[model samples]
Target: MEVIQVKNLSKNYGALQAVDRVSFAVPEGSVFGMLGPNGAGKTTTIECIIGLQKRSGGEVTVLGLDPAISRKELYGSIGVQLQETVYQDKAKVFELCQLFSSMYPDPLDYKLLLERFGLEAKTRTYLRNLSGGERQKVAIVLALIANPRLVVLDELTTGLDPQSRREMWAYIKELQAEGRTIFMTTHYMEEAAHLCDQVCIIDEGRIVALDTVDGVIENAGMDTMISFETQDEIGMVLEKLPGVNRVEQEHEQVRLYSQKEDVLTDLILLLREHAVEYRKINISRPGLEDAFLQLTGKEWKEKVS
Candidate 1:
């Protein structure tokens, strides 16, 4: 079942086109990721879906209801976490949850949510007293309080540290296991690669590539980077080797990057012909990061730390 459908979605601001004819469908009970760079119009596309921004052209439907006409009805079925959140400084954590829960017809257990997020200790704590990660956790709990069928999360792990981010990822998996659909946008490539069932890469307000994470990687038409240490001078035949894209040498180690998966076989043979040997070979597979660069023609390195 398709829970969300967007067709020929276009948004513009004066002479600048923010989003242009973007189209994609999110399946029910699946994690769909919208991946792109800072100015790629990702936020505009999401805002169009949630009815936060009106599009210049195109159509959007959430749960078979038009977002523009059925804005109130749609809110009950979908939860949202924006890129930034601000809480009332004087409000307690538990108090905010209660306030949000009352707005929905059927909300989840606030105490249970607090316990699940390890926020039980902070229930009575003032909103201003919580850390960044804790504040984000509270935002998530509020979004899920209505037990929405579809959740829209933007920059899901923005301010989190490595350990806390991973923990949140695991929690998202739990939501999927319970058959909840997730639609999200993020600058983090690894997060999209790790959690997305289907990915749509956008650039300059247009859709560039849409496929599964592995499919997107394969579509990049780029090869893996293979490196190893060798006492012998492998630079002698590096350019002459078949399936080699480029060659980089750093002292005793030579790194060969290629598009063909079997490039290593040919490389090993070439080494033997030259009577050169290497040790501790390492191959780095092409991932979402490479796909983003290929699709958008942008320079980006994953900031995992």
Candidate 2:
């Protein structure tokens, strides 16, 4: 089932077009990743879908309800955790959890949430005393506490430590197992690559690419990097090989880069035909970041920085 649907969605800030004619759908019980670089209209699109801001134009239906007209009903089914969340500096973790839980009907157990988040010890800690990662954990706990059918998480693991991030990913997978739909936004391509069933890449207020992680990666036309060590100087022979774009040789090693689908097979055959003995051969496929860069025409690091 399509839990979320958007068509011709547009949002504008005066003369500035924040989001332009964006469209996509999120299936039920799936992690839908909405990815874009800074100021790429991702945040604006999110706000519109969640009914936090009025959209300039479009059609949006989440869980069979229009967010504008059925906001109260929508809120009951969706749990939202914004990119930046703050609480009373003096508020205890338990207190904040208790407060949000009270707002929902038949909320999840706060004690279980604390245990699941490895935050039992910090239950008494004040919001001001918690580390950035700890504060993120608290926000996650509150968002999921309602046990809502749909969870919208922005920058879900932004400030988490390595271990904590992994833990949170595992928990999200568990939620998916329980048939909860997740709509998440993040700059972390690796996280989105691993967890998202469908990835939507937006840039400059438009939908640039939307597909499965593998599909997007393939659509980006990024090359696979193949590198190996060889004592022989066969650069001249390899250079003429099909699908070989560029080859760099450093001492006894040669790094080959190609975008051909059958580059690996061709490379191995060429090496055997030339009687080349290679060691430490490795092939690196294009990752989600590369795909994002290709779609947005922006360097991931530059966009984030």
Candidate 3:
């Protein structure tokens, strides 16, 4: 069953079309990810889907009801954590949690959630006194307090430390085990690769690619990358070798991309034949970021930075 369905969804801000004819579905009991560079319409698409923003065109259904028309009805079944949330500076953690819990008929134990998130000691802490990561944790706790059937997270682990991020991942997996659908937007390719069953890549307000993790990598047709630092200028010589698709050279660094399985062996033999000394050699298979680069023609790191 699809917990969320979007068809030709478009959102505009005056003359700017933020989301352009985007379409996708979120299956029940699965994690679905929306990935794209900043200003790629990911947040706008999410807003339209959840009825937080009015879409200029297209349709969206969440839990079989139109979000724009039945937002109140859908609220009971959906929990949302936005990228940015504003809170009263003087508000206490426990007070806010209690307020949110009151909105739901049967909410989860906010006290237990505070303990689970390691915020028990800060239950009476003022919202303004908490660190960015701690505040993010509070947002997550409130999102899940409803015991919602569907959870929507925007940049879910943005402010978390490595340990907290992994802990949150485990918690999300637990939510899935309970048959809750998860729809998320994230800039982290590794996070999407690790948690999402399906991912949609959007660029410039349009859908560029959508597939399973491995499927996207395979379909991108990106070659394996080999990088090394060497004093010898062997780029021209290596480019002529069979199985070497391309070679890039910069001062003492060289990079080779190839689709051939024997490219590594070929490189070794060529280097030995010419007695070209090399160091810091490394080889890597194409991953989610590579696929993003292949389809968008933009480096993931550069995009995020």
Decide which is better by TM-score, 1 or 3.
1
Runs of candidate 1 with Cα error greater than 4 angstroms are 233-251, 269-275, 301-305
lDDT of each: 0.88, 0.87, 0.89
**Candidate 3 TM-score, C-alpha based:** 0.84
lDDT of 2 at 93: 95
Enumerate clash totals for all models, in the order shown: 2, 0, 0
**Root-mean-square deviation of each candidate, in angstroms?**
2.6, 2.1, 3.4
lDDT of 3: 0.89
Ranking by TM-score: 2, 1, 3
Location of the lowest summed lDDT over 10 successive residues in candidate 2: 296-305
Candidate with more favorable, higher TM-score: 1 or 2: 2
Task: Provide the lDDT at 277 for model 2.
Answer: 95
Cα lDDT for residue 132, candidate 3: 74
> Clashing pairs in model 1?
223-258, 223-259
Off by over 4 Å in 3: 159-163, 227-256, 260-281, 302-305
Q: Which residue pairs show collisions in model 2?
A: none
User: Candidate 2 residues 149-209, lDDT tens each?
Assistant: 8999888777666677777789889889989999998878888888999999888898888
Query: Best candidate per TM-score, number?
Result: 2
